[model samples]
Target chain A: MSETKVFGMTPTWRRDVHTHYCPGCTHGVAHRLVCEAIDELGIRDEAIGIAPVGCAVLIHQYMDLDFIEAAHGRAPAVAYGIKAVRPDKIVFTYQGDGDLASIGMGEIVHAVNRAWPLTVVFINNAIYGMTGGQMAPTTLLGQKATTCLSGRTAEANGYPVRMCELLATLEGPAYIERVALSKPQHILKAKAAIKKAFENQVNNKGFSFIEVLSTCPTNWGLRPVEACQWLEENMIPYYPLGVFKDFE
Target chain B: MAKGRVEVREEFCKSCGLCVAACPKKVLRISDSINPRGYRPAEQFQDGCIACGICARTCPDVVLTVYRIDE
Candidate 1:
């Protein structure tokens, strides 16, 4: 027989369909990673995904697993309720920068503080890609967005929030890390982290947060190629790479 | 062995002019004409690029890449 193939053509956790996200958007990569994790964990039959508002609100549409649409910034809380009642079910949330870092910050912090047994997939693209390229909490300084056409300014807008690094400081998150879907190596690493996060939940470890430094070319008024570069040069420096905290 | 070369899917290019600014090697140039999408997408790159993957790394669209030169 031929050598064992590491990657499969289509993940069992996905519906073998496409999403409405713009071309080259990292939402697809993030969705693929979640589908991969669900497939790897063999939880496809008993998995539930909470999708928040933003570009990926329709994430449930593409995923094959049981899905529910949560109010903006309320996914974590909703995931918590579902996980608490159906402790046997594997629960996760898919949220974007605006949903998590902005209006949903309180819910996210509270959930993590409670050490909820759920996995969180946070996609941060710097700008609000869905709402027509507005500035977001993760938007880099001097980055030109629709709201901040002249670029983000410290004096005016303040600096972007480093989500993973800051969350790692909290004593609740069992596993906290930031990964990118920009390339093969990074995607491999991200896949591993995503799997680990799900494993942590399955084993009842605690709060697991994986912030993906994703890209949004259409909103950024850039080609998919250039947006990835901007994320590396500008976003990575502020966010950095590696696991901030792991209690395993 | 040399590293791989860079690949750019110019069709998805919105051409906000970031790649032209990000490429330190000056490998990427902008085209005067617009793409079918109606955006001023990026122009073609000539040889002599180091294939550092910086352009690909910095791009948010996941469209550009630096291929292995030896391959």
Candidate 2:
């Protein structure tokens, strides 16, 4: 088969820094966005990326930007610290649902409240992908994960946190949007939002957050394509994508 | 004969070999040596290619482009 299936995508970064994500996980898509944003912003030299725990811990390895690995749920705080000192450099935090909405909520809320010049790329797959698919704060009602085999019950487990809506309540954020990377069209929109969030940082704007409702097929127990479909059908309704709030 | 150009932008590659491993055409290979970032760059056998974008999709970096040239 002499099909044009030769070689990997040439090194936009490096080859050896292999990702630890499961097949079909959208973390890779998110990583590429960070790289593309840095490349497009021409800030590869002056960009600082803060990677949070919960599956995105190794983001430092994939992105070419100067990366700092933050403690679980503390990326926003670290990002705030960096942006405060190096105000000239662009700073962004890539976080997952558990890391953002769960233990790190206090830090993130305070940071956004203070209107820090930082961007947050939050990945919401509804379940914890790295730690064996536990129920995450963003997990939809009735959704099943390893910890919620019988499905999530609000009486015991609490409600799914709508981050876009939650963050929108704060008037200081410069931009807020929810997007997905499940398909080509959605991926393009996600790229635009991600890039814009970074650009907001460069413009010395207040906090910007783009929540990406991503797919984790391996954790969700669906095929890669099916996972995307599940997201489109079940997840999109609960977490609709749109501009939550934008500041001029 | 029309030839499609498969451009691999080395800067975007993470070189996990998913494409090299997934390609049924076996036109992709990882170099023995590593780059400045300590990752191996993928090598292409253009003669054996059929201009499929599978490698590009499999590539996490989105670094490979398959250009279909009109004859």
Candidate 3:
């Protein structure tokens, strides 16, 4: 019998430690993509990840790399400071909708406008998973969240923010793409987008942003499988999925 | 013939069943038993896996690894 090699195990950049994210949460998928990018780019030592104050706050536990914890909505600013001093290093931020589109809006906008050589992994699960499924700035209209008990209404909660479109408007960003984790096909595209974001930083490109539409099953009151379907049927239409901007 | 096998990191799997739904060969299933995390992990119930890797890609936890061996 001949031995066949089919697949490789986890990426070296990912730690062997167990993750604390709930079952079916896409945060783990996003984390794995980032680690795969780092390993593929041969930047494991030069990569510095800035963790946000959301569900991914404990990202340092899963990724074996240099990571810094930033206060709520301050990851972009913190990443900017790190990249400014160590221009040779690959710096990136993992932020959620609440942390990025809400209080950190100004910081992200200014940083992207400044064209810093850094990457941003934006996880837009619509609702804030860490804070008990509260409505976030990216929550779709008519979506149900703890803060919006009766589903989000345009008249009441205003419209959900389209971050990729918003950032693409600025002249500083070199790349911007939005991908989803609802299915295998979508996941492959998501990995490509994430890899490109990291590659942009490696090439000294300025302000690469990859927004990932993820699932939060526990808070959505749906089974893990149902949440993926919900994200496809409801969230994808509102957020859409594509590259908003790519200078390369 | 070359056969594909899957190794589930039992301790890390949350047993959300996404992989079970994703396997094209239908070789995986959620185990009746629970892991240390108190979640049921997906187990390989058959030996016809093609190592398509769809399951690993679809797994949110990155707990499953697929390998091919000749028999």
Query: For this target, which candidate reaches the highest TM-score against the unseen true structure?
Result: 3
Return the TM-score for each candidate structure: 0.77, 0.80, 0.97
Clashing pairs in 3: none
DockQ of each model vs. true complex: 0.08, 0.13, 0.69
Off by over 4 Å in 1: A1-6, A13-16, B1-71
Q: Write one digit per residue (lDDT tens) for candidate 2, span A85-146.
A: 88888888899999999999999888888887788999999999888999999899999988
lDDT of 1 by residue, A145-164 (tens): 98888999999999898888
DockQ-based CAPRI category assigned to the predicted complex of candidate 1: incorrect
Q: Against the true structure, what is model 3's DockQ?
A: 0.69
DockQ leader: 3
What does candidate 1's lDDT look like per residue over B1-71, in tens digits? 23334565666565545456566668787778776677666654676666555555444344465654442
Model number with the top lDDT: 3
Q: What is the lDDT of residue A16 in candidate 2?
A: 51
